[model samples]
Target chain A: MNFDFGFAIVAAVIVVSALFVVRAANLIHAVLWLGVTLLGTAALYAQLNAPFLAGVQVLTYVGGVVTLMIFGVMVTRRHDGIDVVAQTEGADRGFIFASALFVVLALVTWKSAPHVPNPAPVASSADIARALLGEYLIGFEVLSLLLLAAIVGAVVLVRRRDPEPAGEPSPAAAAVSEVNP
Target chain B: MNEFLQGGLYGGGIIVAIMSSLLFVLWTERKMAARMQSRIGPTFTDPLGFLQAPADVLKLLQKEDIIPEKADRALFNNAPLLGATVAIAGAAVVPFSATIVGADLEVGVLYLLAVGALGVLPVFAAGWGSNNKFALLGAMRAIAQSVSYEVPLVLAALVPVILAGSMKLSDIVAYQSSHHWLVVWPFFLGIPAFGLFMLAMLAESNRIPFDIPEAESELVAGITTEYTGMKFGLFYMAEYLHTVIASAVASALFLGGYDGPIAPGLWWMVLKTGLLVVAIYWLRWSLLRFRSDQLMALCWRWLVPSGVVLVVGAAVWVVFAG
Candidate 1:
């Protein structure tokens, strides 16, 4: 309820992790850091009154999407080659200006931020259920339908189009079998 | 009694209880494993292996904490802590009884499911940090299994949620106590829902049969292949904790948690959970490891459909009953 130092530290970690995700050089590193950012956000959401949404965010966004994106990047690239695509060319003056601006914003925020009060007592899950099923039943059902559609779309999108015959396994599979045997 | 649980002190106490439960469950699990193998299990220390967990903890603490010379020492060191911490955070919402729980938050069920779901990150972190081929493969397998099973687990869980008309664990428990256990009234449907829930929990925890991620014969402990001493111990603890929590959840949802004529509240809850744990272990030993493809197909094809049917059936039943 009262602002615990622990929660503040966690908040800082989450914020810093988000910054790292943006600044990290490697795509893999960025994705991993993004996981940290997502987790931090989920924690923050938990601290708020939205544990369900937080769970959904972490499960779907962090757990599902981020993993898929990382796998996609890895599978698409040359596994051995490290291509450091230079996103920010020499912009030292701009970077310094942006840093100064960020510092000012941080100082202003720190100075003016009101003391956060104790956490309010949250509604029980029953309240949420009553609202969803009683009033928002159609919306809930529609959401379910959308989820089904999304799963179908994902299956269609990721389907192996070539239809490779079962008799001829991929070279990697063959090599794996040889080694295992 | 519920008012006391709503207070801060009891909240903290519940945290301590869950943590101790995690430790005690591990000792029990080891003893069980030893018994199954016909070997003496930590009997020399505590007469009945009661203090075995504490002794094991002390041993782990005393072991030389070594970082691999080539490892990303920071990530490698932190990974176990992350795993353990996330696993602990999951306990906050698990309703042990009518009045015994931590943080009866609005999103209780979802919070438990989500936070528990994040166990994959630490698995990946450990795999990637160690930079071992086996750990990587194990980590990948874990992630795949997690994805495969997650759908069914959530879907099956939704049946109770739909029936209870709440995602709160407390509400679900209360609903069960007031009505019969969902298992009793809807007798046949309960089998599929509980079956799907238990199977998914197994895959989620990376336990036997569903434990290809750490398949000893194939992957040499999978994602945790390279971990040693306490770092390894933490992952082990998280796993046991996951198992205990999964069993608690399954029983809580389907088997009428803390509900019986003879036993006290917590005792009733623990007894139900223990029975579920044994059943899970029995299942693990009886079934062989499913091939990853078969595992995926089983979840996607069989469990998911069953889960959907469960939710729809429950929803219909709830409407009519109301």
Candidate 2:
């Protein structure tokens, strides 16, 4: 198969999945569709000769981020009903805002370069590592620090202030006490 | 076109090999577990139940396919196939020998890790699509467990990549062959990273001590609770296939891959992988499962930090020694 043909197919899949991600009535389906979109983007990265980036994209975005999103959807959903349809609101304003953003994006792309473009040289993983650890060492360190801060913040937010006493009734036990008392 | 055809043939051969090997792995795991538990495992079918895997597959194939009434039909049906595909794909970049890889990509290690990461999605799909609360809970636990461990897994895998100065599996193995197997080289860092990698592998494959996702006593087979027949068989196959892939990757990275004293070749890779598989099976039968909190704690509080240290240590060693 021709490379361009493969790229075109991947692009089509991305577009279709991106549409489904927003249009799907069910939140879980939308999240799954979003995964498909991310997978297509990873394919695009592969096609562009950045296989390392492609792998990282799949690893971080599809594997980590999308899975977390699905977990969030599952946890936050009301369990009283099956297949809760996600509510859609502000269609008119949302469309107007989306269209304006698209226009701006298109204008920026058009203004930047209209001529036939040469593919960027693909950097090996080693080269990327060298660049990060050498030239961009400070940036890399800062990014790590930022991630560490975020992790610490998340842990602090979720950490319990005090441990529950051993003799204290559990939530289920408390419910029983309420019923029996 | 010639390369494509050659690749196609090799890919087909690899898939067939993986499937056949999975049968042997399942049989061995059963016999081992049975022996450990002081019970005779499968023996009636063919020579110590060697054919049990095929027999089980055939039985599943013949069973009625039942989709739950409230299930999302498309996802419910497709999840098992997707799971198997992801599981098998993790083996593609693994170098069995100098010339035996399916796709010797530049980022082979990262590719394997990425594909391995995709395994959780199909389980989540099965859980959500099944429309069963138990399945959903199982999927939730599986995803959380897998994602949490992947942090340490990637970090630990990076130790070898740092030592080798390349993300290619071939390069990593070649580095081990020239210097020493990663498990012994820079013994302090390599050993700990290997340990962490093995722990993560167990969690990643949902084996014992990390099999919370499908705790039979609690979740009634977890995500597979709603699955029936061949679909369930596919999930089982995926799990075994993943364990084998993890073993092969571990062999390549930490055990000098196909390198051996007497004429290094495919057998060396196979032998090393077999040993690791036995270790994994041994652990599965011997260990008790971890609570969810304990599992998360082990990953975050211990493995992740140790992995980071290993990576940094490897980087420093590489710079100073080289």
Candidate 3:
């Protein structure tokens, strides 16, 4: 198959999924649509001869990030039913803003597209690894430290503030006592 | 054009082989479980109940399909197919022998890890689409469990990649053949990494001790609570396929995949994978399931830290020993 044809298909899928991600009424559906868009972007990465980036895209973005988003959606949802509609207002203004941004992006792309190279050879994982560990070692270490700090912050934010007293009756026990009384 | 056809044929052959072998594996799992429990498993189906797997599949295929009224029709319909497809896709880069692989991408190990991770999406889709509380809970557990275990899984797999100096599965295997199998290398680090890999694999595939997602006693089949007929069959097939793929990857990474004494070939790979599969099944029948809190603690508290240490240890070993 022609690479252009494959790229076109992947691009189309990515664009459609991106649209659906914003357009889907249900929160879960929007998350799923975002997943498709991310996966399609990963496909684009693979087509661009960056398989390692593609894998990381799928691994971290689709798997870890999206799963976390879905878990958050599931947990924070107020309604018990899965059909809860996500409130999405102010579409006209959003659309106007999006269109202006798209226009700017398109203009920038059209102006700078001529400078981009064609058919670049894929950078294998080894080369990327070597560059990260050797040439960009400090930057890589710093980025990891940043991520570690973020994780620590997240854990601290979510952790229970204080342990309940062992002698104190739990909520369930209290509720049962009230009901029985 | 010729390459495309060759690739198609190779992939098709691998899928068929996997499906057929899945039947036998399912039967073997049942028989093994039954033997462990001291019961006559599926004796009425065929000779020694060997045909039970096909029979079960046929029954599932013939059953009337059911879709709940509240379910998201499109996603509910598509989820099973997605699960099975992604599960089978992980096998693409695994080399059965020197010449046998569906696709030998430069980042084969990453490809395997990536594809394995995709199994979570369909499962989440199924759970949400089902519009059932139990299914949603199950899906939530599955996503949490799989995503958490993936950390250690990738880390353990990376030990082999670092030692081999390549992300290619074939290269890792070849590295093992030249050196010692990774499960025996560096004595301390290799064994720990291998054990960690096995634990992560079990958790990733939702096997026993990590199967809180599908605990039948509590969740009633978990995310598959609303599925019926062949849709349910697809989920079953996906689970088994995921197990097999995990075993194949473990074998490739640590057990000297397709490498053995006297002209190593496909059989060695199969034998190693088979042994892992049996071990998984044996553990399934023997071990008790973990509570959700315990499972998460194990992953975050134990496996994750140990995996980091193992990776650092492997890198140090490579620097010193290589």
Using DockQ as the measure, which candidate wins?
A: 2
lDDT (10s digit) by residue, model 2, range B107-208: 998998899788888998999899998998998898888888888999989899888888889998999899998887788878888888999988987889
Could you tell which candidate, 1 or 2, scores higher by DockQ?
2
By how many angstroms RMSD does model 3 differ from the true structure?
4.1
**lDDT string, candidate 1, B1-322, tens digits:** 5776547677678767777886667666677777787886788776888887888888988888777787767678888999988877777777787777777765677876777577777877888778788888998888888877888888888888887777777778878788878788777667778888888888887888888888788888887777888998999888777777778888878878777766537788898888887777667656778777768878888888888888888778778864
**What TM-score does prediction 1 earn?**
0.82
Which parts of model 3 are misplaced by more than 4 Å?
A1-3, A79-84, A87-93, A164-181
Clashing pairs in 2: none
> Which of 1 and 2 is ahead in TM-score?
2
- Winner by TM-score: 3
Candidate 2, superposed: residue stretches over 4 Å from native = A1-3, A79-84, A89-111, A114-117, A164-181
Per-model TM-score, in order, reads 0.82, 0.91, 0.93
Rank by TM-score (best first): 3, 2, 1
**Residue B53 in model 3: lDDT:** 83
Q: Which pairs clash (backbone N, Cα, C closer than 3 Å) in model 1? A: none
Better structure of 1 and 3 per DockQ = 3
lDDT for each candidate structure: 0.78, 0.89, 0.89
Q: Against the true structure, what is model 3's DockQ? A: 0.71
Q: Chain A in model 2: its TM-score?
A: 0.80
Instruction: State which docking tier applies to candidate 1.
Output: medium
